[model samples]
Target: MTAPRFLQIHWLASYPGTLINRDDSGLAKRLPFGDAVRTRISSQCLKRHWRTVEDDWALNQIGPEMAVRSREVPEYRVLPALEAEGVATDEIRKAVVLALAQALYGDKAEDVSKRQALLLGEPEIRYLISKVSEIAAAAADAKSAGEAVKTAFKEEKANLSSMRKNGVLEAGLESALFGRMVTSDRAANTDAAIHVAHALTVHAEQGESDYFTVVDDLARDAGESGAGGIFDTELTAGLFYGYVVVDLALLKSNLGGDGALAGKVCEHLVHLIATVSPGAKKGGTAPYAFAEALVVEAGSRQPRTLANAFRQPTAARSEAAAAALAAHLSSVDEAYGAHEKRHHLSLQPIEVPNSSRIGLDGLGKFASAMASA
Candidate 1:
């Protein structure tokens, strides 16, 4: 039997890095599946651009300015509540700090009716904006990321379903099948990818062998220490998880073929993810290593082209400009698809033992402690 066609995905920006101060509109940048610099859209970027948090402790009040005058607001109320409960003043203050953070970043929904009216005054833009907001709001409401995606699909079933059925169609407003063009802001996208590219290049320039092992070690360190605050590792991990789900949702809705196409999609995703990491070396053996391996297993020597430029941004739809890229993405997609064997090196799930203090100790006591707790 053929291996299951689940998407093997990793967030392109899940690895940690210091956020460089730049006067750029895009959040992050990285190299594309091919050799081109493309904007990196991380889970952090998506969440920051959208997502709302619900703060249970914060007082749901009037406007912020009006909230300042109220003694019941978090800045005042939480502290007294803790103090009265005999909590230390310093501890109360720190808890309050966390509370404020929750107020801003937690998954609470705000009444956007008034603001929506003001910003999206035009009916057409308002409709699209409303749909987009609905997608974000529903995703935020669900407890798990998967639930959030389910919520999003439930809300926008018709549109997303259509996109899945038809690969990607661009036409006039009335004739257009998929109205939401993700790449409309081509310049912005390129700029974003460039930032990710610069960071990756800097890492590559340092010169290293054992690229995968070295990067994985760094990723592990960053994750354990929470040094990946800029990248927001956990959330990014969840977001990439959602992206795969979204892809599958599309495939299912489209009612696409389930044979070799399934295997190909899985292979492409795995290879794409391996190379998308922060420190994937650009030269020598690593260049098309994963793709080459996949092609060899599939027993095809197809000459694939990719949209790769020498570390710079380009116009998306420019006929002459996009030709190289369009060719590349096509071949890359196909070459990955042709692989026959199960791509074992794709993704290995890391099991986290359930214990107060994790690792080997957590392994044996996990069940017992959970039962007792």
Candidate 2:
């Protein structure tokens, strides 16, 4: 079997009375579609919800080391490791850390460097700490310790450059999957292996402001009629259509050609996108809802969105949205002649001309076919 180059996941989730994503203006995010404005959720919000969840499907389980994004890596990670290596002089440690931080970030103090956050893998941090320790141990005082960092980096510039991709990872598992951009070192940048599209409602924005008041127990005890505070929050309800595309080859390469790990990651990702909710007001709104319908496609052709099916907006229901999706797929197939293998998992049946219906577990098996190839 020819390994598929891309695996695209499409789903329809119904979230009622929950503002999944909002704007700085304290309103539900909106997208202007063909004739109406639709409630929207940003890809960044979805990715953050997916990546940071410490659950059975967490991405952290995909590897031995995880990545930490912070600007104080030199001060926190590097200094601690150096201190343990008998670099007892506080002046030397602080001076060396400042120099290293400036190099990693820029030629600025801690305040400036604090603005530039970098995602560095634990392994990468360990490497940096070891190198910094070596320089610090050789220096006689803080002045020399600071200069030694610059001199060491200059002398080992060629060797340091290889750190960009020597281990086949830009930094760590998260970096390999989501990617990283280091302005100070352009060579360290890694392209994202997964691409996500912002989720948009299949219909025009369905939202309202919920006016609420908090009662003051003390005031009530004193027979007061006024509330402690009054506020209103935006709430939205609709069937959102979300899309995520995994570049198989790039994923395997990022994980050091471990197709098995990539396959496992793909399995967990499919489950998360289908089951996880990105709702904002969880406690009050209880925005817990799973995908009503999911469609997975594996193909070699360029990945395209089926969002146009709702260009004019569908009824505010899952069945209507799923039907619209299937019809659009059929039309696309009639024109392009169905170049991909597709599978469906849903509460209601959806028929794509050349597609197979599968259970949720079957979704993983279908995508994991790349591992065998």
Give the residue spans of candidate 1 off by over 4 A.
1-17, 20-41, 44-249, 252-255, 277-373
The C-alpha stretches of model 2 lying farther than 4 A from their native spots are 83-86, 112-114, 154-161, 164-166
lDDT of 2: 0.83
Model 1 superposed RMSD (Cα): 24.2
Residue-level lDDT of model 1, residues 1-373, one tens digit each, is: 2322222221212222322111253233343433343334343443221112123211121111111112123333444444454533443343333433232223331222211111001222223333333333333332332343334434544432233233221111111101122221221110110011122221111111221212345867667543333322111110111122212323322223333332332333333333332222223222221111111111123222221321344332223222333344345556565332211111222211110222222221221221112
Encode model 2's per-residue lDDT on 182-298: one tens digit a residue.
776666777898899999999999988899999999999999999999999999899999999999999888888888888988888888898888878788999888899888889
Residues forming the 10-long window of minimal summed lDDT in candidate 1: 188-197
Query: Which ten contiguous residues of candidate 2 have the minimum total lDDT?
Result: 157-166
Quote the lDDT for 182 in model 2.
Answer: 77
Candidate 2 C-alpha RMSD relative to the actual structure: 2.1
- List all candidate RMSDs to the true structure: 24.2, 2.1
